[model samples]
Structure formats: structure tokens, C-alpha cells
Target: MAGRKKRAGNPSPGPSGGPGAPSPTLLVRGGWILSMAPGGFQGHGDILVREGRIQEIGPDLPRPPGASLLDASGAAVLPGLVQAHLHLCQTLFRGLAEEMELLPWLQTRILPLEAAHDEKSIAASARLALTELLLSGTTAVQTMETVHHTQVVLEVLEEAGVTAVTGGCLIDQGEGTPPSMILPAGRALEAQLSLAREWNGKRSGRVEAALCPRFALSCSEGLLRECAAASREKGLRLHTHAAENKEEIRKVREITGLSDIAFLDGAGILGPATSLAHCVHVSPEDRARLRDRGVHVVTCPSANLKLASGIAPAAEYLDQGINLALGADGAPCNNRLDPWRETRLLSLLQKVLAGPAALPPGKALETATLGGARALGREKEIGALEKGKRADMVVVDLEAPWLGPGGSPETRLVFAAGPAEVRHLVLGGKTVVRDGKFLLWDPAEAAARAREELKKLLSRAKLPS
Candidate 1:
């Protein structure tokens, strides 16, 4: 539901495989291509992939010799869903903290568990998160991890072959913070710089670094300003939380004489390079400033409802021309990282809040796909199923009960589809998942490892079994 770009409707030379050998080619045949481009959906479409970029997209493209073929006759081929905001490090803490509000939930359960994490547990958590995301048809994500052992999460992401922009959560202040979780501004900045040096632009630019200041209450004004400056200096994006809870807003106002968005604006952080998550309580002034500054707002509907945080004015945001994307905040709060659930909830809640014409199906789909890419600053590379884009997409099987033969595919996808409908996934021209099964690693084994690591983590944290 945003800007549309013309399709590059031609073949281009692919990345070099070696000195003389040809790059791998894959032909995805006979799917309903939801290009998400200007032309919209195309029936009986064939997508040709070469050297990890989309080489051609049209009907009845002749398959070259020695190319692998994937049949998608009864599927909907579209860009892989992008989750603009997530916490992969907190995936292992699913349901460990329940029925609590934002601040107390963080102080009592999440922060302590995050502080208790060792490298092994953190690695296991990242693996689990990656597995869930891939199986659920999410190919790209922007995630935030806790203060220490952040590199461990990046290592897992790099090995897993998922597209991601991740950062270490910077926490320097705030009452009720664990001593282990607190990091002085200098030390936190040093660690973030180290991570950027090591992991930024890795995996052929599929994974990158972000500057993540935890939130207003957790970081001082000086640290936030430094984060803003560092992001500009390094050409990185800033990720953080803002205006999620009433108590948090009160605390921010008490600390600074302005609201959360106003303080960030004063600190030179409200702009195109920044993405603010869970902006459920932003005022009209805040929204106007966000729209003016071209800042992206990420909505996590399930987490907001679960934490009893207020719903965001998504329709109003769209009307004011502010960019918005959907996210599953974290496993502890969301209990799952499924983008389809987020998409459906994003539309339903908005319609409930502001009449039936609020967020339509196509717009919701756009927010989950292109809007997410725009938030991550990858709108030109990913998001749309057009020629000359990266070959990252998901195939959804429509031969299911919920998605019957009634409405358009977009309507069915937004209002009816779920994880069980995702049949195959292609990332960078590679078949990572086929027939709802991951080709890289066994998800069951990943879950088992996460359980074992959780036991160790809780034991180390002196928590109940």
C-alpha cells in the first residue's frame, strides 16, 4: 500500500559463480505471481532465477538446460514476508513471562532472563527463531538482541542464511534494571562499533548492522544523541522503542520536558534512517512529526494486545502519509513470530477501531512485504516480485479449506490464510524450504536444543523450573 516501481522486464547477467563455470539457475513454474508491482497479479506465471537474482518473470518462459524446476501450479508466488521489528534473542522465553504489563514484564521477567543468557543459550535462541521464521514464510527480519553476547546471535543468523538487520540492545539507565543488563554508554557504543565492523554487510549484504538504543527510559539523552550521530556517521539505521505504554510515556516526560517522539526529535533521531517500534501511544503532534520526518513506525498488534498496551492509529498514520510496517515484537510477548497472524490482526484491529473500510487486504499485504522492506531501507532490492530483484519469495498452497474459491487471492490471504498454507520458500535463488519442510536444518532438533538451553539458562538465573 505504498509506492510502486516499474518492473525491469528483461534478463540480466547474474553474479559470477567462478572463473568460467555458469551460476545456478532455477525455474519456478506456473504459479499465480502476485508481483506486487504496478501490474499486480499475473496468472500462470513462471519465474526464472539465476545467480540469486530474478532473471525473468512472465508466462511460459522456456527452461534452460541443466536448470532445476519447482512446480507451483496451485500456489501463490509472492515476495517473502518481511518482519520489520523482532527480538530473536527473546524467542526462548516464550510464555515465560505472561499476563504482565510492559515495565514490570521487562523488569521482572524479560530483562533478567536476557541478562542470564550465555553464548550457548543465545545461539540456541537465535537458531530457534530462525527456524520458526523460515517455516512461517518470513525470509527477512529486523531484530534486536540484549546487551551482551549479541555477536552470538549474529553468528547464528549468518550461518542460517536468512536475510536480517540486527543490533545489540543498548541499555544504560532506567530504574529496576538488572546490574548485569546495564551497560555504560561508552562500553555499549564500543561493543556496537565492534559488531558493525565484524558483521555489517556480511553474506553478500544480506545481513547488516543497526544502531539500537533500547528505549527512552532505558537510555539517557546523551547516549541517544550519540546513537543518532553514530548511525549517521556509519550510514546505518536506528532501531528503538517509543511511546508504547502510558507509564513509559509518563517516565519519559518526567525525565525530559517533552514527549517521547519530541525528545527523540530534539536528539536528532526522528528521520528516515530510524524505525520506531510499538508506537501505540503517540499523540497527534507526535504523528505529525513522524510523518514530516519520514520516520517509519512498526506495529506489533498481538504483543500490544497481550501486554494490554493501546492499539496504534494505523489508519490515521496511513492517511497522514506516514510509513508503517508490521512486526511480531518477541516470542515472550507475542508467543509466536508468524507474520500472517500479524497481518490479519493488523487489518482486523484497524477495521474495528475505525470502521469497516480501515485497512484493506491489499494494503495489509503491502505493509507485511514492501512496507517492511522500505522500513529496512531495502525497498529497491527486495519486496516486489519483479524482474531484476532478489529471488526471495514464498509459495502459498491455496488448496485448503479456509482459502476457498470465493474472493480474490489477496483477500483470502489477508483474511483466511495461515502457516499451514505456506508450501515452499525460495531465498536468494536457493530452495530453503519445500513442501513446508526446511531443507537446511531440522526444526524439531532446534526446538529440543532450545529447551535444553532454556533449562541451563533458568538454572543459572536461579529461577524456578
Candidate 2:
């Protein structure tokens, strides 16, 4: 017994409540660990977490004194999913804005509804989105809120303990733009910078701010240039949509005498710190610019397909060495803020466009994890289950009958599993979801609040209730 590995002792009541509280030492044992790191996979391994970071990972890591024990037997442990593009403000609009293309969808439904959001409605929407995201195994996201009440959403994100980079959608000029939603260029930039100063690096870096110009068509050249300049000056990330739809692209070209990507580039918005969602209609030149400028492209397959937008060549983007990530977009467009569904669609769509060999299951998983982390510039901190990385991971129950036991863990996770199979979710070394239930928030209460807010929001917008 000289070389025997010591087993962990009994579970202890480790850390106290609250997101700012110190994390407890924890031992997660007996799971199939997918590190998503250079070490690859380990069977029935143990992971030690201390002070919100992964301390050690191996076949049998010794549990420290007074460490909490989480039994992960018959589970698959992988890095928590990251959503690179989401509209947390639109969660309450989920089934209300159906049967429309991209431009009409925004002009007719999304803009007015967004303009109607009060502080309570924004808080309810953020809570609803957060509930679905956490229960579905997403620990980090880059979300864009509507023009007003963004601080409410940021507060909700901080309280929920989800890692995020988010800010208000900047819209100043466009046809049918709600009057309340449009702010002058100078005022908009000043407001966003103020928010960044107040919230960026708050909660020990768990939450941050970004400069989000709504898009080329919705914002004037002046506002876009200002945002680009401020992004560099303040060292904040720039997020927006580009070339998502053919009609939108055409409109952008007509307005600016340049394609969406080219106009964004001319405005100085394309860079390594910027992430553009829905690059579904990029030209070859646009693709080259994206690759050359080291920009990130987030593909929202479900939203694209739902809105009848053409498929993005995600496999081709990967081949072109563009940093690619996955996202659910928004609840109104995608109808569900589920990263697993995005992971599956990210692969299956490629197979349809390219071939059977394109974008395998494992690579799709990487887009949701490592690729998303890179998009948010947090690859070194939170993407993988590696030592010294933040301990944000998901424990998925692999015993479902539909999952069967035949395929590899990655295959099962990408092709068969979903939110229903997520057994536990750990964020910053604390268990946020257990037995498929969210521990830090109440889904039922969130649902009720969303319903109330939706009704009031519809009345305010003068839409049918």
C-alpha cells in the first residue's frame, strides 16, 4: 500500500452562500473527465478545485481536508458551455415574434417590444434567460441587451453568478426605429462608457461590459466610428451583428456603398477583440478580412434557420482559420437558450452543406467551449477543464436510454444529450445546478414574472395580448 492513492473523506458543508463569498475546496470524483485540454480525456478521474480554480486533475486526486465531495459517478464531466452571442433582453418575446424574416422581425416586433421594456420587465427577462442558461449547462456568455435598462440586466447577471460580457444595443438611426430606443451618438457612447466603468471587472471579474453597436444599418457611421475608438481606448470588447441576412446586407450596401463587413472594417470595428454574430452571408473577401483581422464569428444555426437566413459556412470558416464559436442568439429567434441544441445544429448543418465528414461532434463541442472562450478573450481562464483554469464545468448523466452506451462521450453529448440530461453545473467552483435543477434561482418564479411582464409589455407596445 506504499503507492496507493488516498481516497477522499466524507462530504462537508464547505462554502457559504453568495457569489462574492470565498469558494470552498471541493473534490469531484468518479466521472469521465473531458478536460478539453492537451491532456484529453480521462476515465473515472477526480478533479480538485480550490479557490474557484482547478487545482489538480487525475485518475484519483486526493481530496483535501474539509473539502466538499461531489459524486459524479456515471456522469460525463466537461467544460461548461459558452454562448458567444445572445440577446438576454428578448427572452420574453419568444413565440410572440414568429413568421417573419430578419428585417421585418426586428422592425415590426423586436424594436417596439424592446422600447417598451421597463426596469421590472428587463429584470424579469434577464432572470428568465439566466434560468434557462444555467440549467442547460451554460456558465459564460457574451450577451447584448436592448437600448434601455441594460443596467438591470447586468445586475441580474451579477446576482446569478454567470460570467458574461454584456452591454446595451446601440441604435441611433434607422427606419422604423422606435423613438425611445434611439440615443444621440455622443450620449450613447458616454452612457456605455459609464456603464463599463461601473461594471467592468466587477464581482472579481465574473462580469464585464462591452461596446455593442446594434449593426451597420441601425447605427450611423459616426456612432460606429465612435464605438470602435472607445472600444480600443477603454479596452472593452466590441460585439455586433454582420451579414446575417441577404436583404440586410443589401440594405447596408445601399446605405454605405459597401458590404456589411467592409463598412464595419472601414468604421474600424473589425479586430481581435471584436465578435460578430451571424456571418451567414459573408463574401470571400469578407471571410479573408475576418481571418486576416483575427475576428471571431459566432454562428447561431437555430436562429438562422428559423428566420430563413441562409446557412453560414461554419466548416469553411474553421478551415480558413477564423475563430468560430456557437450561440443560441435570442429566445425570440431560437425559442430556447440551449447551448446543447446549438452544438448539435452547428455540426448537422455543416454536414448538410459540406459532407458527412465535416465538423465532427468533438469539434462542434470545441466551438461551444474553447471557441467561445477565445471569442470572449477568456480562453486562458475558463474554456477547458485544465489545471489553473476556472472550475466551470458540467456533469451530464449519460445513462439515458436514448443516449444508449455505444457512442463516444463527445458523440453522445453532441448528438443525443440536452438540457434534460444535465445533472449538475459548477460555476467558479460552486455547484449552481444539481439534479437538473437551478440552485441559485427559481425557474417557476421567473416564469411567472416573465408572463406578467410580457402581458404588460405587450400592452405598452400596443400589440395584441
Candidate 3:
């Protein structure tokens, strides 16, 4: 209600539209278009969207008949941010676990909270995360969920109208693991495959399923192999953690007698279709192998810094020609799901690690957009605002003082702008977030449900809420 602009034409809604439905033709006019594709930006242009795909993009485009005009004056229109690694299940535990290392954090607070999650709790968590993501200009994500009630998370994602590649986290070995987190290797594979069968390409191709093993330390060799085999068989992507912390890396090396990347490669799980979160502790050999094997490295800068996990060599990885993408990780670790924060942190970290030119604004923006789509193997579809690509994009108001004179849109977007400046977000040509508000339901009500659910969950886990 706050961000929806008043126009002269009466717009008709399309498929998801209820009651007085607005038409599917969305005419986004009078904005600078940053397409994310090569030579894709236009200084002053208009976009015509129909049936969820961008029909045309150029200057002075005539509004299509029956089209709903969205005035984008004084805004930058670009592809919606894509997060390659995230944890929607942990959105409810934002401030519950603080000042803890990765392993301790997981074992003490995160695991118990995950173990205590029932269907309702998981649904609440997913809804909270999705709402935050949509409002922050993130139209797509690759979410790694906990063991049970994964269907509930998927249902929430579908209902929220966000594009995602998701899977249930697998943890079969019981040693040093919570009992509730354990599942038989074969059983876990079966469950994931079942989920893929049901959801790999659901929601008119907006949703897909992936195979996510918790990590090398927590999973057995058998489970890792099965995950690899299943991914190959089903043609699905593999998402998992790898070498985030020093202790975790040492444990994996001791168990498999190989580094984490080598072990994963030996397990047939490292390749173009795989997206490994956090390679913070990768060895020199890890870089070569990752480049040659074509694995995508997903970096979560905020979470790593918060946990005191050493900064990932993102600059080095990019130099080695490894495909890189950005993520916010989980709320407990990152404390927020805002992509703008992640982008700014990523840019700042690279500059500290290398130099002033290490990560430019344009490069950082690409990592969140095109690089993310590449990580998810969706490079041809939704990352950019091209003629044939899906209309998943965000409109950012450039009037904020932090954006200072605003010569380069990409520079301001990466360093100065934030979620508060997001005026509108479009997902698959549908106005899921309009005028800085979610159209489906009250965000206040969703936040309330999240608090109530988190209280019940902490009580169930015997922890203070």
C-alpha cells in the first residue's frame, strides 16, 4: 500500500490476481535498466512484460494494450538479487545464538532448535524468511532446510511466490550429532529423491529441488556417494557446506584422509552442478581442483565474520576462474537475510583481502545476480533483464542521501542502497511486492506468528525464549 504508485490507466491483474484481477501486461516505464547481461543497461528505458517473460526493452516503448503501467521514475531497475546459499529454517533463531563458533553454535543452539521444529514451526520460519527476502529485493534463493518437515518449507515457498532451489539437509551418522538429526543414509536419499520427484520443477518452473548433505564431517562416505549418484541420476544440483571452519576442516581431513574438496571430489560430488557453501579454509590445491572441476563457491561473508570463521579467499577464488555467488547464510549466523548487506560486506571484505580494485561495484552486483543464477544452473533464465528472460527484478529509489549524486547506478546499488530503498519487486512478471509491501498478507501478522512459534519452539527445546 505504501509503494504502489497511482497511475491513470486501470490495470487488470493476471493469474494470481483475485477478485478484480489486474492484467498480466506490466509496463515498467521511465527508469534506468541494468540488465546484468553484457551491454544490457539502458539509461532511460521502458520494459514490457507479458506471461512472466520480458517481451521488450528499449527507449520510448509504447504501452501495450490493457497493460498495467508502473512508473519507475527516479529508480534503478535491475535483476532481483539471487542468493545461492541460505537457511530458511533458521530464520526464527536470529538472535537466539550469539558469540559462538560454528560447531558450538550448531551443536548447542541451532541443532536443538532444528530438532524441535514441528511442521507449524518450520512453516512459520519459512514464511518469515520469505517475507524478509522478498521485501529486500531477493527474488530467488537456494535454501538448505533441516531434516524433517521439508515439505512444509516448500509449501511456504510456493505460496509466497518466490523462486527457489531447495532441499532437506541430510545427517545420517549419529556420532556427536543430535539423535533427532539422524536418519538412515538410504532413507535420507529416498526422502530427497521423493521430494525431487514432487518439486524439482514445480510452480511453472519457478521451484526446483536439490540434494543437500549437512557437511563432510557430519555425513558418512556412503551418504555422500548416494547424494552424488542421486544428483546425477535426477539431474539435480547438490548444495552443501564445505571447509567453513578450521576445526571442521581438520575433522574431515582426519576422517577421509583427504581435504574436504578432495574428499568431495572423490565422492563424485564436485562439479558444475554442485554449489559448495563457504570454502573459507580451502587449500591451494582446492582452488585448482575447484576451477578444473567447475564447482561454484557460495560465500556468506556476514555469517563467516560473525562466527569468527576466517574470511573466505573470495578474491583468490575469482582470480582462479571459479564461479562465485553470494549468500546471507542463516538468520542465526547472519542475523539478517538482507542481500544488500551481504553485497556490501562481500565488497568490503574483498577490498581488505586484496586491494581497492579487488571487488568492484559492478563485479559485486554480478555475483549477486548473474553469478547466482550460474551457481544454480539457471544462467539463461532469471538472472538478467533481457528480452527473453523471466521478469524477476527490483526497483530501487535513488533519492536517498547515502546514494550521493548517483552517477553510476551499479555503484550506488552495491554500496549505498539497501532494503529500505526498494520501491518494488517483480517475480516472474507478478507484482509479489508492491510499493514496499507484500501483497499477499500482512507482514505484521506474519511477524507475530513467527514470534509465537519461536516461543513455543524454545519452550519445547527446554530453552529460554
| Candidate 3: clashing pairs of residues | 3-435, 4-435, 12-22, 12-23, 13-21, 13-22, 13-23
Model 2, which residues run further than 4 Å from truth? 1-22
**Model 3's TM-score against the true structure:** 0.95
Pairs with steric clashes in candidate 1? none
lDDT of 1: 0.86
| Best first by lDDT, ranked | 2, 3, 1
TM agreement with the true structure for every prediction: 0.94, 0.95, 0.95
Residue 115's C-alpha lDDT in candidate 2? 93
Better of 1 and 3 by TM-score: 3
- Please write out the lDDT profile of model 2 over residues 1-465, one tens digit for every residue: 111112245243345322335357878888988888756655779988998899888887887877777767777899999999999999999998998999999989999999999999999999999999998999999999998888898889888777899999998898889998889999988888999999887666788989999998889999999999998988999999999999999998888899999999999999999999999998899999999999999999999999999899999999999999999999999899999999999999999999999999989989999999999999998879988899999988777777766989889989998888887788888887766656786789999999999999998999653
**Lowest lDDT 10-residue stretch of candidate 1:** 1-10
Better of 1 and 2 by TM-score: 2
lDDT of 3 by residue, 1-465 (tens): 223343345343445432122337888888888888988866889999998789999888998776776667778899999999999999999999999998888888898889999999899999989889998999889989999999999888877776789999999984457797899999988888898889876656778888999999878889999999988887989999998999888888777799989999999999899999999998898889999999999999999999999899898998899999999999999899999999998999999989999988888999999999999899899788998888888998776777767469888888988888887788877787665767767789889999999989988889544
Each prediction's Cα lDDT score?
Answer: 0.86, 0.88, 0.86
Report each candidate's C-alpha RMSD, comma-separated, in the order given: 5.6, 4.4, 2.4
Best by lDDT: 2
